[model samples]
Target: MKDAQKPDHVSLNTLIMRLREGQFVIPDFQREFEWKPWDIKELMRSIFLDYYIGSLLLWKGKQENFNALSCERIYGYPKGNGNPVHIVLDGQQRLTAMYYAFLAPDVNLPNRANRALYFVHVDKFMAEEYDDAFNYDWLTRRWSKIIDNPEVQYEQHIFPLAIMGAGGWELPNWVQGYEQFWKNRTQEAEEAGDADAIEMAAKSTENAHLFGEHLKGITEQYQVAYIELDQDLAVDKVCDIFTQINSKGIRLDAFDLINALLKPKGLQLKHMWRAAASRLEFVETEKMNVYILQVMSILRQSYCSPKYLYFLLPGQEKPVRDPDGTRRKEVLITDAQDFEGRWHNAVDALQAAIKLLQHPHEFAAISSKYLPYVSILPVFASIQAHIKTIQASQRLDAQRKARHWYWASVFTNRYSGSVESTSARDFMDMKAWLQDDNAEPPLITEFKTRFKTLEFRKETKRGTSVYNGLFNLLVLMGARDWMSGNVTLADDLDDHHIVPKKWGAEHLQGKVIDTILNRTPLSAETNRHVISDRLPNQYLPDLIAENGEAAVRSILESHCISPAALAILLRDPFTAEDFEEFIAERQRTFQEAIETLLVKERLDLPVQLRELDEQIEQIELGLRKVIVAVLQADSQYELPSHILRNVKERIQRAAKKNAALDGDYYDTLEGKMEFCDLRELHDAIKTKALWPQFQPRFVNKETLNIKFGQLAELRNAIRHSRSADEITRKEGEAAILWFAKVLK
Candidate 1:
């Protein structure tokens, strides 16, 4: 009945030797080695930085212990004569990672295709850039050359970590050799009288010696703590010991820590989480529990990182800025009653947010997987709660604005990183924006800029925000089932290739065929049975015959495939060229849909006006390219004198006022071209000196004037953020189409 737990430590040098000799074995019940290359690289970094990597649990092994529980040699350990003395109960991942990295095993890491070699960037290590110092790469032919060549490794200032397991004289010899190598280069540079090369080589030599000593010191002196169990302990007792030790050692995130902190206040955060868990089960994320607290924090103090979440505990006071813009202290939760009330309110708001998100006509995030940004949930829910408190009539307008913000956040990836500050700022801005027309969140302007150039042709991944946003757009568009020709539930649809992947692989070599532009949500049955492994031309003709062209085209249009794109799809012997054209046409369709649906003004414009607007944008863009080319050829890329005095000066003034406009000359010029109406383009073209260079592109100044005047009238009306009258739309359509054709 003696207590079996004993504390122990081992120098890293001895530990590496033991691992190399296979003296310690892993228990068979242990999980498989799953550390990625990055994870292994991080461990190396921690060891080099002398950070504590936590304690290992070892059970003293005997014949009975081995017989009771099976054991295996550490993964990738070479066969050795050394006998196993201990069973690893914990730290298998760390040990295996060390074995893989220090030993540089011929075997690959788990789930990896190629063997990996780990290296320390000596310069980075010496400079204390620990995060960038440790690295690993597949032992490909290119890397093999670098690994085998000492000169290349030294030139790159990378020292391979595998030499540690070589034992005894190997590492010291490498250190000495590395220093001498750089010293020789330094001497050569001095002989050549190359000041820069001498300085560089001298630094390398110094780094070499310093890094060698530091690494050697770490290997010899670094201590790994462990808990040793007596050999006589029962297997059941060992299991219990492991469970207790591991459970205690597990790190607590903000939610778990806050839960523990709240228990003494007579508030059971765990019980509350259990009750609210079912409500948030719709989203497939473990962070939902933490998100509830974040929502509460965001609602209270407009900040929700772990630091702010601590203030939500009972009796915790956080500083706040009032609605009237006065700073004050506010107790986030006064007591258990107030704490519970806020918690439930936050949970209820999140539930309401999820309902709106999954609504087909709203964000159309029918499933958690298709939801654009889970990180946006705190702000989303907080804003939803804010909307409810406003007047009922105003709530609808407020929700419309909120929907715009949500889509903007998703498409622009605004909430992807450092969500705490972003959520706080956005929540405050959105509140202001909802109450006043002039107070628009900066994210709206960002989305306008980013969305204009968002290349759907490169969005090939399912998990990306843009990819998911596009799929959700399809859901909102009421993308119909291809086979049934009926609008289908988003849950029942899976994003499938418009052009079968099998055909693209065969015919469209080197083409990116899986872009969202070439994919749409379709029923699984339709993908398998109807469109199975066939080109769109092969299947669509049959669909058109069955459902008739009108009905089938309507279904395709719902998926954002226009008639022009359909024609490209229906092209016989659909070539890669056809695929490119189809994607281009669909890109335009999707872009238009986003503008009409998400980025539209408060008042909807006529479809003809929207189409005319798109046409004008394309025509002006093409005209700018022509103008830039002509100007570059004529003025050697210099801004024309008139433009420099007028448009350039005006833009520079604007950029001075708005920091967002600040950039280099060419950037400012591009911004000028993008923002300037048809008037500026006309002025540049009609200028006395630049007229001849632009004359060949147009018939004459008279013709140019007529077209420019037509476009200018409509552009002014649309760019003013209002719907243009019918006469302006008609004239603009004619002029835009003419210019679009001329530009093409």
Candidate 2:
């Protein structure tokens, strides 16, 4: 039996060629294709990263063996004579994934509704972001066209993997075409004198060449190992060998290996887990087992990757780095007792963190499904443990800071990619913040800047972090059951539609009717009996009749629906326009609630600066109305010739530099005013012709110019995202009052 012998290697290019030619075949006994799309993406990523993807076991098939075993072509392979040379014994899943990705056959994945296609993001690949470089999409008509269109592919910086499997000069030709496409674009940008576009296109051209070389390297050099059994070997012997290989129990992960490694050191890692399992059972994720180890590593060395996790073993030295990276040392784990202590501490901390997540008064992730990011739990638990160790008076403040961090992380999708490094960095940043409140992490500021513009309408899916986090927010808001009028119990709540799905489907055509703006937490019973298949205008009156309007309004307020939104819902005509108004009003209410409860001090600006900022906004509004009215008072609504020549030309030049102003610049006079800075508005007013129209309101251009200058200084401070000094605020306040009186 030469069954267990030395393995030979085949390059990926050769393997793909063999697959296309139907040289490799699967025996009838092999399992059907079972890999998921994400699994296929990971395989592609590994191949690109040049990581070992294990080996294949094959039986060298003769005519007699092929006839006896009833060999079949791989799924999605064209049916033909096939002229099979080998029958696969192992690695069916990997080989099939490669075939599905590279070949991109016209078939849906197993048990999936839509056909899938794989792509490589050339920009991400060139940046060495292997995890995010590979992606797949449903083969809809739109995606099909996108993959086939070379211009669209170049614009998006993605490369179709199927070209590689097309087998001849197709890949190299496509790569060359991509490089030339960007080179031409760079030339066009240069001709247009757009420095930014020129830089972008030139960088894309360089990346194209780099990505092409990388792809060529992977295809021609990446190897797959395989062991072949002789054709002369009997079928019974081959069948027995396959059974022994496939009958293995559970596949080992890092945790299992670590458990065994700890046993010889007198640490029963498995026994500790058995003891702690009951406490963590409420989390309902298998990953909780390894998260314990990850948390331990994070608390010890501020890193939880596999390489750092190994340092937790007894007598293993963990390299410690100073903040400045100037000092470093290896600190050994003292003993098994020390390991056990860390394990227990991690367990306790994780328990506390889970309780906080499920607590209605805390982060309010009601259940596993409602948890915005399970991947963030390890760092979260470590932070919670640190909070407990602080002084009693400071613990509340520390917990509040932690809560802000959690919400910011959830909303920003901070843990979605490169989780290990992100977790470590956040842990370090948060630890610093907890000790010194002035050193807030960057995510809190990011959340504040983006919170107002968050597109709640796009959050239509239930399982995404933003969707689940919004639901959790409703639960935390103390959403009440309509019929029962009690606080919503976590386990009993469902994200039910405020506007019944049936009514919305009929009336809200072309609108995203299932957005979070239209959904809120309600008990299953309330959703079924109270609000079933009825509009809010229809069911809300019934609720008000049962409970008084005041109580019902209070209940609605708990769901972040303000009195204004309630009025919109209770409109008599209640057309689709009212529904849209209700959605907008409720979104505004949610923004207010989020600002008050979570992002209390986004910029941490002083109260005086905020009031001054609002004053400046009011002054600007007055100026815009006066300018537009003066311009439109005669025959047509237009800027005066001199003002247009000076102010409009300058604003248009600024628009070219700031892309955000392009749309406004091309619009009407009012739209152009929206893009105008305070100084530009002052320029228009101080123009010789326009000064006659404004002098009556302002009394004189000299005072107008001085007050406008003060307002401009204050506006500049606010726009540049900095606080005005006390002297500037005093002068700006005087100018605000002066303008308000004059405009009046």
Candidate 3:
């Protein structure tokens, strides 16, 4: 096949003409417009100075592929197919900036005001005697107005670059007008017979003549270069080139490529994502499009990253060599056939997820406050809620399961770093659940319940902290707006410590009041007017007097304060200071409420290490099991009683030595024994004094020591309370099973 084997370097005028005629297009997979006003100015300065900005990489597609190319133009899209469409694979930013900077307001452009705007400095080429300097100097506005109307706005030089927008920036008439005006003035001066005035007019005319020259230089020239790639290259190869060109500079965002891929099919990804993200009230908009795009990938491609979607394109069997020496065949445009529909589904799922978070049956997120883990959105969006394989009745069941998983994910932070892999896994598991009624819910291997003081404080801040998932669960249990009669919590509400900070400061250190149990959501009105010194008992009567006791009781019930707990704070005398007791009681309820929700839905995981104690598989050390297996290979290597004596004596001697060497106090027997741990015992066993206790009874001492060292590592991890990801499921179970068999 004969491709147009060369690149062409045309004048900037020809490039703009091609763009105006729809020959140049921002391909569907290119990124959304990201240049700012400053970027436009810098680019314009570079162009005016004839600086080499960069070259454009345009994929000059074959007629069929070009015909398939319907894309967003740099400014206004061309009205008719004046030339074959060529995709801009690079130099889009510079081109876009220039196009918008000079797009004429009169060109019947669609939404001209909202698309892009630019302005040019007119002071550089204005008449020195002109009074227009004050009006245009150092101001920023779109250059889409009267650019050449030198006398329109001010006394001196100012030009709207927009005058050049109508494809031909014909030179200005002001200089000529001034020249004609000065010529007329000379005649009048000569007639008046004041020779000195004539001389002054002549000098002004000379200045006017100079401005005309500077004005022509800006309007007549355009300077940008580009390389147009022939259409014979494969789509994958094109993407590779696009990525390589951008890698060292501004890296190509995957969303940009997706935009290019989708535009040919009538999907304006930027507009679609903008609409979707605006609906997300409090979740910050930074990378919101990327997140939604990832969600779309998960639903459509069963992947969380768009880069991975490249391979899913319809590839050809045989590769043909391209002009760039890349051997590749064209992939059909059918690669994006169902993208529009699937993206809509993802949007629907995202809306459903937002709603689920804001208003849930139990453990409601209420708002962004409780959405600590942002990674759950993709997994939630990929639920395949209305898959055809799912029965009508089971759809609701599947949704319920999704909800359970959402809470479990929030509790465990399941969608952390491996968000893509986790989303794919969760979606597959969720899809299976929907299709096959007997499919079990996905497993949550580990979760953490111990909220460290500082982290908990950070997490519990009303709308600011991510720790609100737990707070939301507590609210679901019964925490309600004290004055709102249990209405759904509003974003405007506030939270205050149950034990006032000033009072608790004497009893505690570093924000003793800044805790989940101590903090409770208060109505905005109450928060604004409350007396900080007043105890809940004191505040209760006033609230009851204002809103009535029945309303107050409803608020307390909604806030998850049990009647008994409220009674202690409201006892008529109310003399006893029971903030500690009150806090303890509430904390217990909070913990119980969480457990209740987890058990209610069977979405439970052992969030606490103690919960995994009875089920030792969680903390089991696999290396310990290997050591036991090697020891038990003889089937008769029971530890001698004398070895136990040796171990006990070794522990006692170590404690005494530690006390003497480190000056550690050990008055009680229990205190001395506290230093004893499995690793410590193993260390004692490894000592030369105790090594011979079972040298013959067991296997190789060297082998056992190496395995025991691994066991020591596992013991250290457990002691430090690391996540269970530190150990694998097979390793955990193997350790427990092997140890049990050997111990028996």
Candidate 4:
């Protein structure tokens, strides 16, 4: 059933000789050579030991469907061609490694272009035992002085693996010169009075002769095994045989196949894609292939995806990429010649789309790092390319529509599935909206209102789409630092909590700290030094005393707080009861701020916003009682000093684990430790294993430990700048009710 015959044997010299003369070619379907230096070293070692590495699989074909360029690509290759070119279907990695190690002394890998061609010296190393076998340990791709040693002679010490064919250079092997070097080394060692060196030199002399003879036999006589498939086979059949026999498990990629297809037609994939992509500096070559294909599809069929680049069109009766096969439009370009002008426009449109995102600076909230969705770019570019010139009046309307789509897409997790499908639909939708005069964008308000999932989650970075959207929204509304006067920059901003996590953890079990309602963007420098886990209730007034109330309130309103909400939160000795009310009130303002983008209404922020000072006073007294109970349960004498000392130890331990979590309390131990707030005392106490001390009195150790862990986790979420909005909502009320039970 098979067209190919049994395996055949060919000398390494003969094989390379054929390769250099363009007699051998690598098929486009094969993966790029991926052997590292270790692999090369091992392969050479096996060959020197005369072990059977493997046979090369050659597909002898009448003609290639792809490029003939592949035929001329053997390293150290001569320009002339033989009658037929054999495609090496297998053993490419091993063959490439051999070439990199022994031959191709001038070729360099792309990254290390300045380096000399790879080599390994046989008789180069001298300090150790004189063995005929070359050490394959330092198998570096780059050249070194050791590999280029003057003592090494061709077919003797330094072996050349690549030079082959009629036109190749051959360096003569010197037998007498190798003997003279060892004799000279022996004389020098004798004069130095080193017996070991003398003995090694004499041994090197004998081994050099043996090694040289062995190298000569291998290069001149030994054969490298190979199998050549029948030339009468079809391209697809050859491909199937190649794939079935390939040991390296490299799958066929679209680009390689496409290049092969284009090569016969005198078109190069790299040249065509590069000419268009170099105009735009941001996208890389591999991605450019995708862009070009998408553009060509849009130009030809007006329906495209990056997947189109690899699809076998015009050749295959039905080329497939998408699970749902891409439907070719009736207007598809029948030939490649008709496709160029359209591809150029697609390139220009892609560039224009990037510019459109940057034009008014409002959209600059996204950078390459936090793009949220990359497919959005090319799809948007394609849509904008089809449209007429925009009127100035229509720009605002266009922006509103774009924003609605952006926010809705992010919050609703629209593109989490099939991006090409989503992009196709979105592109069509935008095209429809851009054409219609009476088009109204989807109500962002409805999306936000239906969004029950808008809760804070702890994350190391702000790369998520939701985080990106929220940051852009805050930037849209002028967010500023409460402590400093400077406008906040996201790069320098910290998502800071308003109510100190430490105090909330103590009184309210530290729940609700990571909520977007609690977290506001403040300058990192101000947040680090000013807010430092101290509640706004206490810190705001302290700041107001130093800097006037007007200065502080201005910054709060910019964070989307109403003046009334700010006043309620700013109350002195703000308690856990007041903390609950403050979070509830602040959440409402946040909602109103989001709604402003859609409806654009002013909220009537009443100045007499309820401040529960009496309830706050009662909560503070109750908290002091709880602290006194916790401390006195184990120790009754000099309770204030005992509490202070215990809290100091807890602060020192937490500061050790992560100094950032300490809120700069590490800088001044006496200041942080001496007569701090009840909340601070609670945080310090919670850090220690104190439930055993309170065992059988208030709660058991297990219950106390669980309660303490939940509270600590709440503080941890804030300390790490993670989301705890759900914790705040879930645990805030329960903690307050538990405290209410404890107080009763």
- The candidate maximizing lDDT is 1
lDDT of 2 by residue, 1-744 (tens): 444333466999999998888888888888998999999999998888766576687888898888788888898888884568889988889999999999988888989998888999999887778778899999888987888798899889988888889988888999999999999999999999999999999999999987887788789878776777788888999888888778863333457557766877988788889999999887767778789998998888888875567678888654454667443547546788888998999999999899989988677788777888888889999988887777987876687688788898888878877787788998999889888865777677678767787878888888778888888888876788888988877778778898878877888875568889999888899999988997787889998998899999888998998999998888877788888888888778888877755675322334466566667877888889899889878644456455556656656554543444455445667766665667778887887767888778888888888998898888777645556788887898899999888888
**Model 2, residue 124: displacement in angstroms?**
20
What lDDT would each prediction earn against the true structure? 0.82, 0.81, 0.55, 0.55
User: lDDT (0-100) at residue 492 of candidate 2?
Assistant: 87
List model 1 lDDT by residue over 376-488, tens digit each.
Answer: 89899999998999998788668778878888888898877888888989999998998897577667877766787899998988878899999998887778899987767
Candidate 3, overall lDDT?
0.55
Across 658-708, the per-residue lDDT of candidate 4 in tens digits comes to: 334445543343434333553554553444455344344446445544553
- The superposed Cα distance between candidate 4 and the true structure at residue 63, in angstroms, equals 24
Count clashing residue pairs per candidate: 0, 0, 25, 8
Better of 2 and 3 by lDDT: 2
Candidate 2: which pairs clash? none
- The count of residue-pair clashes in candidate 3 stands at 25
lDDT for 637 in candidate 3 is 43
List of clashing residue pairs for candidate 1: none
Worst 10 residues of 4 by lDDT: 601-610
Q: Which segments of model 1 are wrong by more than 4 Å?
A: 1-251, 319-330, 508-511, 601-744
State which candidate has the highest TM-score.
1
Write one digit per residue (lDDT tens) for candidate 3, span 1-744: 665324334565565566556566776777776766656667766555444465567887766554454555665444554565678888778776666566542332232234333443344433332222212112225232334345442233344444445564343554566566667777889899989989967765665665455445444444344566778877778777877777756443556555654555566778877777767645654556666666666655566654344432333122234777464544422445455565666677677766766664544666665565666776775674344246665565566666666666765556556676777877887777666654544352222232211233334344332356666665555566665555545666556665566656666656446767667766666655663666676777788889887777766755657676777777654432465566566666655555544533422233343333323532234324433444455654433355445545655555442333222443322333333445544554465654665455434667556554554454334433344565543354444454454334
The deviation in Å at residue 505 for candidate 2 is 3.1
